[model samples]
Target: MIMKAIQKYSVVLLLLFIAVSIAGCGNQKEESSAYSIFYINKDITKIVKQPYEPVADITDTNAMIDEFLGQLKTDPEDVEYKRVIPKDVTVLDYSVEGELLTLYFDKHYSSVEPVEEALVRAAIVRTMVQIDGVECLTFYVGDAPLSDQSGNPIGVMTNDSFIENPGEQINSIQTATLVLYFADEEGSGLIQETQEVHYSSNISMEKLVMEHLLEGPKSEHAKSAIPEGTKLMSVSVLEGVCYVSLDESFLNQDYNVEEPVVIYSIVNSLSEISTISKVQISVNGDTSGVYRDSFALDKIYERNLDYVDAEVQGNVIEEGATEELE
Candidate 1:
C-alpha cells in the first residue's frame, strides 16, 4: 500500500514542475515584445496619453497659430515690434485623403508679389513640417494648388485633418496643419513669414574668430552696437560667403568711432560666421542702390563711420540694484 501511494505522489509532483516551466517560458516571450522602442501602435488612441512625449507633435499647431493671430490684433500702444505679419486672406481648407495631405486655398497670395509669397510659404512650411506624422504636402486652390483659406470642394467639413502616415486613414480631431505660406491677398495687417533659412554649412579658423568672438554684448571693437531685440533684416549666403544685413540702427546707434573699426567689427563678426570668407555690409536691405551707388556708401564706411568705445561709455547701473546682473 505504501509503495503504491509513493508512485502516485511522484507523478503529481512531476506534472506540477512541467506546468511551472511552461508558465516561465510564456512570461519571457511577453517581456521580449515589450522591450522594443519602435513599436508602432495600430491604435494610437490606446497608447498615446495626455501630454504626449518623445514622439509628440513638435508645434501645438492649433494653440500656437491662434496666439500668433491674436498678437496681430494687439493695439500699437501695447506692442513695440518692427514688422507684424501681414494677415493673408486666402483659402485655408485642408484635408487628408489617404497618405497625401491636401491643402485647398485660393490664389489670393500671388497678388502680394512673388518675393513676399515665397517668404510666407517658407515660414508656414517649416512650422508645419516640424509637426510629427506629416510627410508629403499638396496644395490645391479651387482646381489648382492655390485657393481660399477655408473653402474646398470635396467634403462638407472644409477644415484640415492630420494623417498618421502619408497615405493612411484620416484621423479626425487632428487638425490638418495647412502648409500655407501667405494669407489672403487682401490681408492688410502685419505679414508673418514661416520659413527657415540657413547659410553655408562650414566652419573654419577665420569664420570661428569672426563668428563667436564678434557677436554678443562684449566685442573687442564696437562697444555699444546692435541693441537687444533688434530684428535681423536679411542674411545672404553665396559660395561660402555670409552677407548679413540687420537694422540700420545696429550701426548708427552703436557707434561713436572711426570708419575702420566699425567696418572691421561688422566684417569680422560675419566673416567669422563663415570660414574666413568675405563679409558685405548693406543698409536697410540693399548692398547696391541709389543711396549706395552714387555715394559709394560702402567706401564711406572706410572713412566717416564713428564707433563708441564700450569701455569708456559703459552702462551706468544704479548701485546695489543688480539690474544688469539680473
Candidate 2:
C-alpha cells in the first residue's frame, strides 16, 4: 500500500510540473505582443509611455489598433499621466492603407491648444506606430487633414515629427531652398524662382512648396499662379506621386494665369523634389472633375517644361529649377 501511495505522489508531481511549464509559455507569448502606450503628463508639457499587454489573444491588426486607441482615451491609473485625447475630441473612425494609419476626429479636435496638440500628435503617432504593420499616422478633422492656424496641412506624421519639449518644439525653425514656379508677365508661361525660407520643421517639404506658391512669387518677373484664399487641405507623397488636396477656394482660378501655366506651375515646382515624379491636384479630395476646362484634376501630371518660359532656363535661378532642367 505504501508503494502504491508513493507512486501516486510521483504522478501528481509530474502533472504539477507540466502545468507550471504551460503557464510559463503563456506568459512568454503575452510578453511578445506587449507594446508601450503613451500618455501626456499632468502638466500637459510632454508625453510618457507605459508598457501594456493585451488581456486577450489579438492577432488581427485592426483589432490591435482599436485596442490601442481605446487605451489612449482611457485615463491611466497613474495620476502623473493624463489621457492624451481631449474629452471633447471623438475619434469618429480610422482606416489603414499600406502602412499609413489615419484617424478621423470630430471638429472639436481642432480646439486642442497648439502646444497640447503637438503632444497629442506625438503620443498617438508614437503609440500607433508600434503596431506590427503601421509605420505612420495622420489625424483628420472631419474631411480635412489637420492644419495649423495658418491653414497649412500638417500632412503625414511619423515618430520623428515631434520633439519632446515642454514648450512644444513643433515651432522649431529649419531652413530649406524651395524651387517654386509662378506665371510670367503675360500669365501664359511658367517662370521658376528660388527662395531660401525658414519654416517650421514640422511642415513637410511638399506642403512647404504649396504654401510658398500660395504666398505668391517674390521675384519681379514671376506672378502668382494659385488663386487667392486657397487653403491647402493636405499634401502627401506615395510611390513617386505627390497627392495635393486644396479647399474650394482653389477652384476660383485667376484667369490671367492660363490653364496649363497654373497647372504646370504646381507640377514642375513640386517635381523639383527628388522623391516626387508626378503630381495630382484635387479640390477637397475630389479628383473627379477638371481644374478649368483642359487640366483634369483626376489626371496625374509630370513635370511639364512646355509652359516654362525660355528665359527662365537661361536666367540665374540660384540653382533651384535650373538643376531640375539638367
Candidate 3:
C-alpha cells in the first residue's frame, strides 16, 4: 500500500512538470516579438507600415537594417506595399553613430533615372528615419556619397527633408532674398520691399514670394496688392518667365485699387529673381482674360517701376534739380 501511494504521487508530479514546461515555451515565443517593418507605397512617394507580427530581437540595429532592406527587394504582389529599391541594388553595409545612420549600397543604387533618384532616396530615408534613435541619414555607394540629378550631394536627411508637394528633397531651412511689391497706404502706387526669408527647399522661390505678397506687408506703410482670399493655384519659372496663376478672387474689384498696380505688383515682385526676366499672370490657368479694361492678362509683362512710390527719391532729385538751376 505504501509503494502504491508513492508511485501515484510521482505520476502527478511529472504531469505538473510537463504542463509548466509547455506554458514556459508559449511565454518565450510571445516575448521575442519586438518590431514592425515599413515599406514604400505604390507611387514611390510615401512610406507604408507593413502589417506583420512584431519581429524578434530588433534591438540589434544592424540586423534590423538588414531585414528592412531585404523587404525592399520583395515583389510588389508578394507584399502588401510596393518596394522602392531596385532589385539590382544591394546593401553593402550600414553603421550607426549616435543619431546618424549611414547606409552603403552597391553601385546599382546610383543607376536609377534622374527623376526616380530623388524619389528613391526619399523613400529610403523616410523609411529608415522611422526607427527609434535614428534622427539623420546619409547614403553612399562604396566610398563615394550619393548625389542628386544636379550633382548636388544628397546630404544628411531628417524627417522633414522630404516634402509632399514638388516631391523634392531639400534642407529644412533655406534662405532666399525676395524683393516683394505691395501697395502704399493710400493704395495709389506700389512699394518695393526687400526681405530676407527662410523657407524649405521643397518650395520654389516664386511660390514663396507669391505667398508673402498675399500675406500683406509687415510695414504699416505698405499694403497688400492681392485681393483678400486670393488663392495662388500655382507659380513656376521657365525660360526666364514666371507664370503666376490665381483663383477667381483675384478678379474681384472690391479693393478699389487701380488694375495696373495689382498687375505690376505680381510682375515686379517675381521678376526680382535673377532668373525671371518677365511674368505672365493668369486667372485659374486661363490667360485669355483681362484685368479691369486696359491690363491684358494674356500678355506677359516686364517689371514696370513707373507705378512705384518715388516721392522721397523724387524730392531729393527735385531739390538737386533746383540747386542745379540756381
Candidate 4:
C-alpha cells in the first residue's frame, strides 16, 4: 500500500542527516558502533555486507532511509563489492507508513535480470530495514506494486526474508523435484505433474512447494487449482500434518473450479512430500471458520485419489464414478 510521497534529497545531504541522527544513539568511539551496508559481490552471485560508521547522528527518519539508499546506490570502497542499485534504476519516490517503507522506482527496475534482481532486492531490503523504526519494506514500479514472476505480491520483507549464513553465504541455490497437483482443463479434476526446480536453499521445501503451486501449471491441458492473487502467508509441517496458512484472498474461489478440487489439489500436492501425510489449511492462521459451504478450514485432509481423472489412473476409478466424486 502506497502512502504520501516524500521529496528526494541529494546523497551528501542524506548522509549528513543520517550521521547526525545516529550519533545521538551513543558514543561515537565505541568499536561496535556500525551498521552493515549490504552489497552484491563483483560476480553478482551473492550479497555481502560492509561495515559503515555514522559520523554524527540521525534525527529524521527520512534522512536515515535516504542515507541507506545512497549507500546502496554508491559503490563500496572495496572493488570486490559492487553497488546493488544499477545506474539505470532510480528511486522515483518513496513513502513510509508505520514501520513499513515503500519505495517507488522507475520502470527501469523491471528490466533487471531475475537472478541479479533478487540479489539487488536482498541487498536493498537488508540495508533499509536497519533503520531504528523501520521493520520492513516493499517495492513499487511506478504506480504498480512489485509481484513475483508467478504474479503473487512480494509483500512486506524483513531481515528474516532473505536467508543469510552467520558469516557471509547468502542466497545460496539448491534443487529439488516436486510432484504437484493442478486442475484439469475443465477445472473440475486434479492432474498430477512432476517438476524439477532449482531454488534458494534459504527457502524451506514446504514453502517452495507452495510457491510453485501458486505459479500455476506448466502443462498445456492443466490449470491452476488455487485462486488468483492468493498469498501464502506461512506454511509448515508438524507430526505428519502440513499446516498451510494463506491470506484471505484464498477464500475468493474461482467459480470454474469445485471446492473439493481446490482443497485436495493442495492436500495431494503437499502430501507428495515424504514427511507430510495430511494437510490442514487456514486463512491467516485462523482455522475457526469453514471454507465456502462444506469445506472446513480447520479440517485435516488426507490425499484422495478419487478426484483424479480416470483417464490417468487407467480404470482405477470404477465406471461412472467421476460424476459421483465431483
The numbered model that scores best in lDDT is: 2
Question: Candidate 2: lDDT of 164?
Answer: 40
**Candidate 4 structure quality by residue, lDDT tens digits, 29-133:** 224547889999999768888888654677588988888888888978999989999999999988987776899999999898776787888889778766776
- Report the C-alpha displacement of residue 290, candidate 2, in angstroms: 2.7
The TM-scores, one per candidate, come to: 0.28, 0.67, 0.49, 0.63
Q: Give me the displacement of residue 18 in model 3, in angstroms.
A: 67
Pitting candidate 1 against candidate 4, the one with the higher TM-score is 4
Tens-digit lDDT track for model 3 on 1-326? 99897544433221110000100111111232343445655554445555544266666666666666666666555454666777788888889977678989888876765434555666666556556666667788879877543233444555444445444422234568888888877777887776787665555567678777887876666788888888665565656877677778888884567778888989999888889998888776678867878888879899999999897335444665797899
lDDT of 1 by residue, 223-309 (tens): 422333433333434455554444455444332333344454544444333243655555544555422114333432221113323
lDDT by residue (tens digit), candidate 2, 278-325: 998888667888878988887899998888787764573545466678
lDDT for model 1: 0.31
Error of 2 at 29 (Å): 19
User: Which regions of candidate 1 deviate over 4 angstroms?
Assistant: 1-215, 218-222, 226-230, 250-255, 274-276, 289-326
Which of the predicted structures, 1 or 2, would earn the higher lDDT when compared with the native?
A: 2
**Top-scoring candidate (TM-score):** 2
User: Candidate 1 or 2, higher TM-score?
Assistant: 2
Candidate 4: worst 10 consecutive residues by lDDT?
Answer: 14-23
How many clashing residue pairs, candidate 4?
Answer: 11
Instruction: State each candidate's clash count.
Output: 48, 0, 0, 11
